[model samples]
Target chain A: MTVDTAPDTQSQIHWFLIGMRGLFSLPAIILMLSFVGFAAFTAEANIPVDQVMFMTGMVWALPAKVILVGSMLSGAHVATAFIAVTLSSVRMMPMVAALIPEIRDRRTPTWLLLIISHFVAITAWVFAMEKVRDVPRYGRVAFFAGFGITLTVTNIILVGLVYGAVSSFPPIVSGCLFFLTPVYFLTSIWISARHRVIYWALGIGLALGYLFAVIAPEYDILLAGIIGGTLAWWGEKRLRQKEAGQ
Target chain B: MSFDGVWPYIYIAIAGWLATDIWRWAGVIAGKRIDENYETLNWVRAVATALVAAVIAKLIFFPTGALENSPLWLRLGSILFGALCFFIGGRFRQPLGIAAAIAFLAAGLALIGL
Candidate 1:
């Protein structure tokens, strides 16, 4: 059984196919549904479907896309939208940082790795991280690109289709659809979290997000993240020291 | 450069790509030199995770567009239920948590005659 696939493992296309198979995985399926919800969201905002598709493809990260659309819709200045989007997507750095080492071999070119890095959003990151170690070292790039490309292209098309069709959807239905994105975000983040500090971050971020929204609605997300995240990091460091000292 | 007709689209494309991809590029550059488990990466991860959490919380609490129509209690309750089940669902947590939240949303909407 293992013998048949072993020979082909060296071929990037073979590993790419293996990665594409992950499109049917549970997270991928849920992410597809979440994108459908995202499409309905852009529709309600009166954004052109083409623009929605473009943003989905370009931004790729759902949260950043949401902040972009939300800020744009609210008539936020271009600079504000830019900063909010940048802040929202800063997480991609860590995700790519963590995932790159797993997939890169010595001979892998930086350019090729950079292209693969473009695809490292939450779902694909989680999926690739979980599966990459099982892949032969050289094929990891193709394997990740296969899944990432397929996912990005599929979502771009999915958003276009859903945006067109969702115009006819009842407000209640679309609202329910929109709700899936947050639920997916919450649960998936919880599941993918590698450290206890995430719980602290989540709790503090949530509380401060609400507080900041009241006091300074414009900078709420950025402020909450920076302040809450630093506090959580510092607090966790203290806890670690206490345990080590004992 | 104007905030006129084609400008927002251009902005979305350029800004969106840069905002997200710059980090990926940085990761590739930095990843080459350092251990993935480097302590500094943890602080970066913590900040990133916190930022995302803030985004999620904001979506639920100060939602714009259609989700703004749902009552606060319904939104809050449904998400809490979903979060709780996220733990209990174990192997099927992602789907179960998602399904659980959507179901609660639909049910809550229907109950309130929405």
Candidate 2:
């Protein structure tokens, strides 16, 4: 597994092996740590561990999983949960759209691409997008699938173990576990922010989230996100126009 | 209409799995048609970022689980401290920032007699 031979043979399995090697990558390790946090969260929320495992593999995205659990705990209606998860998961669209073409060519099947798309959340997306360019077109899907399947299965097992183990842990331990996730997201989002507008969106979203939680707790995430994001985008557009005029 | 065993899984399947996967399905369908750098993609990115930020805010300010055990100050302070570290340490310090946050939280929880 430690060997990195050249692509004399472009077998899908060879590329898949290369992808599986990312199991030890920094992003994968960080993701596992985050899932440990998520597992602790689900345990604290009193969600069944099996269900947490299910959601981990099925929902796939951390944010969407959090929203689902949050919505459930907050007693939001099912429809509301659906909508929030949908909105949160919309981020995957651009990632999938961007990566599919890079990895796919005339030989790739739509069904296979669809299967691969399930693994296109943040960590895998970042990893695949960064590495796929080096992969031959025929093997990119296998490479991504190898990484994706390994990552997902590893996380599902991690969450299950953590959820079961968190019960015996002290409050301080669980508290620290809970603390890892938000910090991870905040720093990662800040670091990965591509443009100035994202900062505006983040600030506005945080501020408006607090306000909406007070006024309309169930809809806080939705309302704050739409209004704040729109405002940020609109502000950026206006600023660009003003600069153009000047 | 119930909040019992297995029901939540069903809801999650529909609301969580279906809701999330639809976007990926759409992306695969639309991948060939749209440029990744299309202008509207920026707005989509903004909204997505905002949504994720909103989720983070909710987790910090109004968590429902064991995280609620800690005081609001600890929750708020640790995040601020982490962000501070992130900025000061420059790029490639995300691990440092996260480690700082976990330490802050653990120390805060211990000091407060949790």
Candidate 3:
């Protein structure tokens, strides 16, 4: 049976439909909110009280916020904290590379590009890739603008709430919110995998990283990603070649 | 605690935001010339995805703070249960169900004290 490939116009219409489908999905909304809540809490705990509110409003990721706040809390020099936070953000380079093709257009303005660059965090990037991939290239900017604005507003509000309500909130509730950030990430990865070896890589990587961290706390993430990623790449290549030969 | 002023924080936040934006702009410039299905890009995507996966797995399995305090078996069980949920959810093409599974596993762990 020949598969029916719809015309490009029809396909574009279908893409918009899928985008709308994801727009109202519960997981999409929760994942978006959880990312903001985690960033807010991290900022609150680590950032100086003065910086906490503002960073939560702007800084996109928890790791960068953690580094920024942690360094400042330790009374490190401002330059030192900046350097630390920037170093933590080195991972963003690859993430940006992966996301750019999904959003960029020939006519896209430089200033708009600047705003997008500033606004695209890891959570936003992943959401854009998964939810907006099928969106017509011409419509992606609007989709991103809509999605990014919602996330930004949600983050600002959540940070404000956490900042103002921390004293009254139960410990478990706050903890759960924090916990959901990683949980959401883990579940998303688990759901998105199309290859079996990727699963093996994640499983082995976690075990090795955790054990090594117990022995040497520093470099756990570096070791895990480098070692696990390399192994998965190699294994996947070999598996694909074997299938081709068959 | 003395650094209670907001100006310094705003300056830092603005600076951080700008610094991160640099990478995004560069990606946009570079993306125009690159082929998405190119083998090199595919490998890059794989590596990036794997790195993220490694980090997420470490967070769930090793954990910290309240999660670290929870019993080891509970953590492992919750993750396994969550993975199973992810599997079932994906099989049926339901992302929300997978998220629900994770939330359920975490809440269950918290309530059971293990």
Best DockQ among the predictions, by candidate number = 2
- TM-score-superior candidate, 1 or 3: 1
Residue A15 in model 1: lDDT: 81
Candidate 3 C-alpha lDDT tens digits along B1-114:
336666566556644665455556776565555645655555545555655665565666666544566666665665566667665664553455445645665577667754
Tens digit of lDDT per residue, candidate 3, span A175-239? 46556666666655555555566566566666656765676555555566567666776777888
Error of 1 at A128 (Å): 3.6
- Candidate 2 Cα outliers beyond 4 Å, as residue runs: A1-18, A40-51, A63-109, A122-144, A244-246, B1-12, B30-32
* Total clashing pairs in model 3: 0
| For model 2 chain A, the run of ten residues with the poorest summed lDDT | A1-10
Comparing only chain B with the true structure, the TM-scores of all models are 0.73, 0.74, 0.64
CA shift of A182, model 3, Å: 2.1
**A-chain TM-score of every model:** 0.78, 0.71, 0.74
Per-residue lDDT tens digits for candidate 1, residues B26-108, read: 87887776555556666656666676677777878977666787799999999888878877988888788888888998899
Which regions of candidate 3 are displaced past 4 Å?
A1-24, A32-50, A109-111, A193-219, B89-114
lDDT of 2 by residue, A127-183 (tens): 675677677677777899999999999999888877877656777776776667667
**All candidates: interface RMSD:** 3.2, 3.7, 3.5
